[model samples]
Target: AKGRSATIFVYGATGAGKTYTMFGQGEREHQGLIFRAIPEVFDAINAYGEADGHLEVKVSFLEIYNEVVRDLLQENGGGGACRVLEDERRGVVKVANLAEAPVRTPDEAQGYLRAGIRARTVEATAANAQSSRAHAVFTLTVEHVKTQSQGN
Candidate 1:
């Protein structure tokens, strides 16, 4: 599974349970995709049996409101808007000056996620009481390095 990549995009109309499906609510057992998926990733990494290798996981949360990109984990809601840029070297889109929190456990990841969610833009509308007025993106990056033997 070298150089593997995956993306989970959640989108729908207001009150369509999009937020619930992504973040869930109430009971801990009713955790959403972000919570559930993170643990699975750790489990998979552990199952890989990389005794001498090192694996690191980082998460970044952001929201796009009125074409402005904001970092959910940063202070004062990213302290302003962030720049969306294209990384020529990686050939991927990225947010400039975005904060990426390193997570070693699912609970750690959840903590950052909770903080970011609190910073997200949500409002009460006539149609949907609690409606998110922006598009949120949660990204998880995994970096792994395999240990090399001296004889190799």
Candidate 2:
């Protein structure tokens, strides 16, 4: 995967394994990165720094629910929120500051994820009691010093 920037998109109908697959088991011990990818990325960066070298990583989370944007991190003081903001370039949308949760290990990442899942919004719908009616985006920004460069 040299010179490749990975991008993954998980999508499916209700009751599918989209979330479960991404986040692993919902159990506290087995919780995956589905809801905590940003924190996980930070944890990875920290781990890499400790083992290999230093690097900087930033994360952000956003959600669009019923045509409305909600911040999943700022709500309840990092416990979770539905705050929406306007961006001149990105337009109006909901965004979360994942930098607030700095995870240094996989366990810490899992803890944040468990808290996030508990705080996530769920409503009882006609078809499903707990239905997810929004799109959640977890972004990770990785920066490192390049030892070598390719010339055009």
Candidate 3:
């Protein structure tokens, strides 16, 4: 279980709420999973009040278009120019130049998400001009370290 990891893949048929549910369409009341999950996670973590441990949340956003990956949080186009390689020793897949952002609060996370969303591949559509043309992946890295009171 320690070595195993999980991922939440949000997908559905076209016109379904995949985009709507993931990115929150238009208004805040209709916020999507990505938006809603952030604060809730932080609140739950913070509920421990530093007694459980010190937690840090780092985030990253990426998009896969036509099998090519683009780093959403990266300012330069070079971030997209990555080579995929597998680490046989560690049995892990690696993207050479993808970017990961460190975020403390939900607002900071939201800022990264917004910037990532804006960087996504979108084009004019009959339903919405800003329709996402690629599949986007938002990742959060939660690192926890126990305090002296909790552990030696």
Candidate 4:
């Protein structure tokens, strides 16, 4: 697992700690999961980068509100029709210009993650106020150089 690509999904009820378990414990004051994991992931990447190779990581943060996919990173805010473009060969769907940031250190990644999370949309329904009205997806793609010997 040292040099491999993976996709992970954190799904659960509201306030279920889905993000916490996947990422890590949230800040002591804020108590959110993404806050914890961003730094950890960045630290891992930095450590790996210092060794034999480097990791090129791209993060895309998004939110689906009222059955509409919204770009969390959009400067104008989200609340309109949006489209998902697919890469046939790669078998992936992505939102255009959805806050893709390249981060090297855990601290930098943490900052970006915090900013993106803050930009996410939340709503208050009859059942639950201060609830996330949409599904949030944070995708991190990591690419590392591999040698033929290691491929064996």
lDDT to native, each model = 0.85, 0.55, 0.78, 0.65
**Residue-by-residue lDDT tens digits, candidate 4, 12-37:** 77776664564443556654655656
Where model 4 places Cα greater than 4 Å from the true spot, the runs are: 1-3, 13-26, 29-31, 49-53, 76-82, 87-90, 145-152
- For TM-score, candidate 2 versus 4, the one ahead is 4
lDDT tens readout by residue for model 2, 6-110? 677888878776666666665556654454455556555655533333564444455666775555556562334444556879675544343445544545545
RMSD of 3: 3.7
Residue 120 shift from truth in candidate 1, angstroms: 0.7
Candidate 1, which segments miss by more than 4 Å at Cα?
A: 87-91, 146-152
* Clash numbers, per candidate: 0, 4, 0, 0
Q: Which of candidates 2 and 3 reaches a greater lDDT? A: 3
Error of 2 at 62 (Å): 2.4
Every model's TM-score: 0.87, 0.58, 0.79, 0.66
Query: What residue runs in model 3 are displaced by over 4 Å at the alpha carbon?
Result: 1-6, 49-53, 76-78, 88-90, 124-129, 146-152
Let me know the TM-score candidate 4 reaches against the reference structure: 0.66
Better of 1 and 3 by lDDT: 1
Q: Candidate 2 regions off by >4 Å?
A: 1-4, 28-53, 75-100, 145-152
* Pairs of residues at least 3 apart in sequence or in different chains that clash in candidate 1: none
User: Which one is best on TM-score?
Assistant: 1
Report the error of model 4 at residue 81, Å. Answer: 5.3
